[model samples]
Target: MLNRIASFALATLLLITLSACDDSNPAAPEEPVELDTQTVEDLPADPTVTVGENGRPQGLNQYTFFSLRDNEIVLESGTEARADSNSTAWDIALQGTTIRINGGTSGPGNGAAYVAEAAFENVVEVDTERLQPDTEEALAIPTGSGNGWYNYNANGQNYVRPIPGRTLVVRTADGDGYAKIRIQSYYEGAPELPADRQAHPSRYYTFDYVVRTDGTPSFE
Candidate 1:
């Protein structure tokens, strides 16, 4: 009788231990939330004070530092931008037609970028190997008219316009997140006819972007 009782006790103890082990097992991790696309309209990038005779904006050579994570302009003045230039608070900086990411010679952040030939919405993934940080000799997003994001004086047009089908694939300030940007208009209010300098003021950036902050390359 004692032997049978001992066997029963042992079985009960084994079952209890098994149940405890099952209860202690950790739960599976939840899936990361998908990020949404964000649109920024009329984010001023230091509007020019005068329009030159050549129909190009002149004067007010200052950069407007913007944060993609915050989706806001962090600094608009040259002095303030210079003071915070080394920080990662701002991801990108724009002055006239020139755009600079936060990495390399531009700033202290890990920011980098590359101009993709694909359409904005079609670019669902980023190739991190192709990304390049800003440098004195060359920029990730090249400067000059047709070389980079915008085309200057294309087809005899005097005003600058974003090159169609070109999208900017950017590594955020933290270097962990990624974002894709499509420049809709460089003029304020995103005018239908951006070449009409009289009506459409230049240097304002209106763009659509999708940011993924979960440290993933997927923009979806």
Candidate 2:
């Protein structure tokens, strides 16, 4: 029995030595303490509004300078877009010179900026004695398509020579906003003969008008 006890003691000592050998290397290095790194992503604003980089105004406006300069008036939003210009954008709902001139665009998609057609004749002031108040819209596209005059008439009787350096006041009849549209119109090239569809392909005399705004107009 004493020999067996001595043998057991020897076995226990060997087990301790083997266990110590498994962890013999400087505390087993604590699993190498790995540091983890994380990543993140950035996103844009709300998902409702459509954002396009194709010349949309700096402040994300729907209306641009080209839109205003090309047409006599424009609504800021595509929702309330009226078709007056003969371009592809014109729709049947806005046939002829049907600009409401309310000075704003209406609809769900309207952006921050709105543009109105800058007229060459906001106010047509002619000498009263020679008054020819013709309400007919003289749409003269002598060399034109994108922009021309409409709903404008000669409010004087006798046509007078355009005075040099004379500024006339044109205004927005729907509101206080107004601009000078024309200075004078006259005969040019050849007298255009009335036609069934097209105005006899001849250029007529027309007086140029100017636009006054807060700053140089912009589109995109």
Candidate 3:
């Protein structure tokens, strides 16, 4: 009886020791999701029905919805984009100079955004604390000539251009991760010098972005 009890105690002690060793060295965390820089060109943001005298989009007011996760245009039509505006299928929406995320007053998703003054490549990590969702009073990405991501009639060029050193850091629609966007041009074909208003259509977006789906905040 004494021998059996001693053996049982010894076995229990060994088991406990093994369990402690296992706990000390937990499994390594899974690797963060890998993503590549993606460029989206000529994404129509409510292509104008007519060019005004000032060389801006006139009439046919609408928004083009885009999905950062899917990396595709979710909705391009005015009616369809509005109908699905409440859904999380899209992460961002654009119309003229206005940009919207899929959170707050925009949609039901957890999307949020803030414009970073750093260059796109220089922004290696996301500043999650500064992010804000769209609100009725104001948008996460502010609009206007000198505000947010663009400058209107820059250098008296008579066209809108993305402001240099301005990058958009966004909390993805699902709120699972983050993304960074650098708008290269606001004209069709991403012309180097969009001097001719008629030749270079307005409201078309050319931008590059990188998205991480693993919830990591670092772009590297």
After superposition, which runs of candidate 2 have C-alpha atoms over 4 Å from their true positions? 1-94, 97-99, 104-178, 183-193, 196-207, 215-220
CA-RMSD of model 1: 3.9
lDDT of 1 by residue, 83-192 (tens): 77668999889887888999999999999999999999899889999999999899899999889898887558677889999999999889888999999888888974
Best by TM-score: 3
Stretches of candidate 1 above 4 Å error? 1-32, 50-57, 78-81
**Which model scores highest in lDDT?**
3
- Per-candidate TM-score against the hidden true structure: 0.80, 0.21, 0.81
RMSD of 2: 26.4
Better candidate number, 2 or 3, judged by lDDT? 3
lDDT to native, each model: 0.86, 0.28, 0.89
lDDT digits (tens) for residues 1-220 of candidate 3: 9999999999999999999999999999987556799999999998757788899648477788899988998889455436677689999999988999999998899999999999999999989899999999999999998789988877777678888999999998899979999999988999855878678888889999999888988898
Better of 1 and 2 by TM-score: 1
Colliding pairs, model 1: none
lDDT of 3: 0.89
- What's the candidate order when arranged by decreasing TM-score? 3, 1, 2
List, residue by residue over 1-220, the lDDT tens digit for candidate 2.
9999999999999999998988775564544322221111111111123446784422222321112222332422233453422232211111112222212232121111111243322223322232111123421111122233322332332222333343333222222222333323222322222222132221122334333223312111
